[model samples]
Target: MGKQVVAESARRRRRPTKQGTVLTEAHIVETALRVLREHGSAGLTARRLGAALGADPSTLYRYFAGMDELTLAIGEELIGRALSGWLPGGDWREGLRELGLRIHGAYLAHPQAAVLTASRVSGRPREIEADEAILGVLRTAGFPDRAAVRIYHAFIDQTLAFAALDAASLALGRRARESDEERWESTYAKLPADSHPHIAATAGLLSARMKDSAYPAALDMLLHSAATQLAAARAADRGASGTSAR
Candidate 1:
């Protein structure tokens, strides 16, 4: 791990491509992102990345050990973009909510790449920084250390999990996506009310809402539940302290 970190740092310094284009690690990551966006996940091969950078595929090995490493780099870039220029506003709930939205938006913007890397643990600089920032916000909101850590883990995991799921839906082939939409409209909305009373009754609303993702509602529920837990913990602590005083 130490050696890999050192190598990553060195690669970020500078290098010259055979085509005379200066290739830094940043350039490689940026180009990789573009390739993922343009060609989709399967199109991110070393040969394709090399062609995009106007260099030999072997040139990429010097900066990244392999495609896995390069993929991690790209994932870190997505995380960095999500937290870029973000500052906590002291209200932890709103701060965390905004961060979640930013992360979700960034992933959805690069649906192909998000499907590839959203659930992977990069353990890179940006990923670490985002984790620390989230924990900090939770602690600032008066959560005890253990509670903060627990909530932080759940928050990050939930956000990434949803991002991956949504990205997968977005990354589906055009025909497949359309087919799903058509199913929701034609099949689901046409269910017999006698056989499936609930779904049939709400079929109209379901069809209208299926066009949008359910992430926002899910996120709100998670945050609300966490807030309730935090409040209960605080109340229990206060009661314990009063009892001890008596």
Candidate 2:
């Protein structure tokens, strides 16, 4: 604890930017996020971050050990934003549903940053709190410890995996993205029925649906499965209690 305090004190030493502004860890992280958004993932180099903050690149090392640490911090910032005003209602299924959506929305909001950080384990305070909050929702909703842990693992993994997958599509170059969109309509929709009967039969529907994300549908499936498990567990408990009474 003492070592952590000393390290944090050292990290927080205020430095002056080239633009005559003051630099803090928050400022650097925020600027890095903007850089990632505006310039794409590759643009998030130390030199670029330094230029964005109007400070030397080396100055960032004071707050972060390296680019990896900074990236983790950026990921944590996204998690923090996702949970900002979110409180779980008593309905466990709906609560998990909303939390999953909030996280997906927050990451999709910054595709480049999301692409960089979605698969990472931030292990920061916000990330830890988010995990605890989800587990708390499951436990309080009457799930046993083993079941709660299983569901919690599935919930977090599915949410983040979808976020990363969707964000990758969003992070594509403008021309590449346009090409992908065009192919769905001009190529896939126009395929000959004889050679690809199933796809051809559903081409109209598939083309219409391709533009939207699959995350919502996927999240609903997970929630439904969890609800089924909870109901089954309850039924099993009732059966056991009835037998004991007899």
Candidate 3:
């Protein structure tokens, strides 16, 4: 048992495999994502990854503890993509909106991977950085710590939730996805107004809008609410200042 542990540790320290291929953690993660893209989450076995990298299956253990650790790395990669080249501007609202959109876009770009990692809290560098950046935005915008934390929690959770939901739809096979979308037009649009009055009245709109992800609209609503709260907080602070002066 002791010898096995030492052997595994030695393998982990070796970067170059016997196949003459050098494997870095980043390279492994990139290969894993490609495997995910081509064959999906379930297909991302150690054997498959090793074959894709032209290395032995045991070579993967050098970088990742197991498939679960690799999955968290994949999730971190998505967050890194979202944060790449992102600079927060003066307007907190706009900055946050852009961040939210980038996150949603990154996940949707890799729907197969997103379906697996969207809900996993990686606690990795990229994820921690994103949380810090978001909190900084709210704090710099004059929100108190409590309010910033509350809004940040809701903002991040809502963004990931929508990303996972939309990714699931995108992960569906083409025929299945098309059939699902067609239902909005074929079934809902044809519903009788007498029985389903509200849906029937908005059937046209539903057909057009329901086919799209609601993340953008939902993000705007959340930002609007936060703005209102900030305004009220500012007013209360001013009133308190005035009372203190008197």
Candidate 4:
């Protein structure tokens, strides 16, 4: 009896639900994202997804093994969007900068989904493609394997970290978001000069700047540091070659 039940479950997954609605993997992933955006991660369940899809909840298992697999699919979808129509240009730095921003923007565009999936490791095609692209950009620019891998790790992590952080803020309710934003002007901007001298002095700048995402500025600093490292590595290589020639 138990074996029959298991076999039946497997059969159910192989075919669409009795609803006669043909559900594609892409369709299910997209619907999952919509459910995530409208209702959030906690609200995403088999029953909720079924209603959204106009099919049985079990139909989702036909495409994905389970919810964890679905989450990875959602993450890959965001990465795919980041890579959509994007090609690396002549300037590696510029290419990397654009890639970083695209990734950041993609996550911010789907803040609710980002909050759930940004930290996930999908290891899926889209994610793998993105990794390969970043590494290729660094290696083609003359970075050694070690340096390229190191920079790639930092670059991807920093971009996703900021994406997740910014997305968390963006995912908040309107009033909550406003209240958090307002704290900069209402609290930090008004700090008394005597006790908090530095903040008071830069309060005006802080008020203006703190209202925006700092990812761009942070990305620039990272790129600049990478440029410096590349320059130093080249100089060292040249020095070693000159010594060998002597």
Q: Which stretches of candidate 3 lie over 4 Å from their true place?
A: 1-21
Q: Please report how far candidate 1 places residue 172 from its true position, in Å.
A: 1.4
lDDT for predicted candidate 4 compared with the true structure: 0.89
My TM-score estimates for the predictions, one after another, are: 0.91, 0.93, 0.93, 0.92
How high is the CA lDDT of each candidate model?
A: 0.87, 0.89, 0.91, 0.89
Worst lDDT window (10 residues) for model 4? 1-10
Q: Which ten residues in a row have the lowest lDDT in candidate 1?
A: 1-10
Give lDDT tens digits, candidate 3, residues 37-102.
899889999999999988888867766777888899999999999999999878999999999999
What tens digits encode model 1's per-residue C-alpha lDDT throughout 1-108? 422434655654365665667888898988998999889999999999999998888778878878998888888989999999899876788899999989988898
- How much does candidate 2 score in TM-score? 0.93
Stretches off by above 4 angstroms in model 4 are 1-21
User: What lDDT is reached at residue 8 by model 1?
Assistant: 57
Q: Which pairs of residues clash in candidate 1, taking residues 3 or more apart in a chain or in different chains?
A: none
lDDT of 4 by residue, 1-246 (tens): 111223323444444545555567777788888998899888889999999888878766756778888899999999999999899869999999999999999999889999999999989999999999999999999999999999999999999999999999988978999999899899998999999999999999998898789999999999999999999999999999999999
Cα RMSD of predicted structure 2: 2.5
Could you tell which candidate, 1 or 3, scores higher by TM-score?
Answer: 3
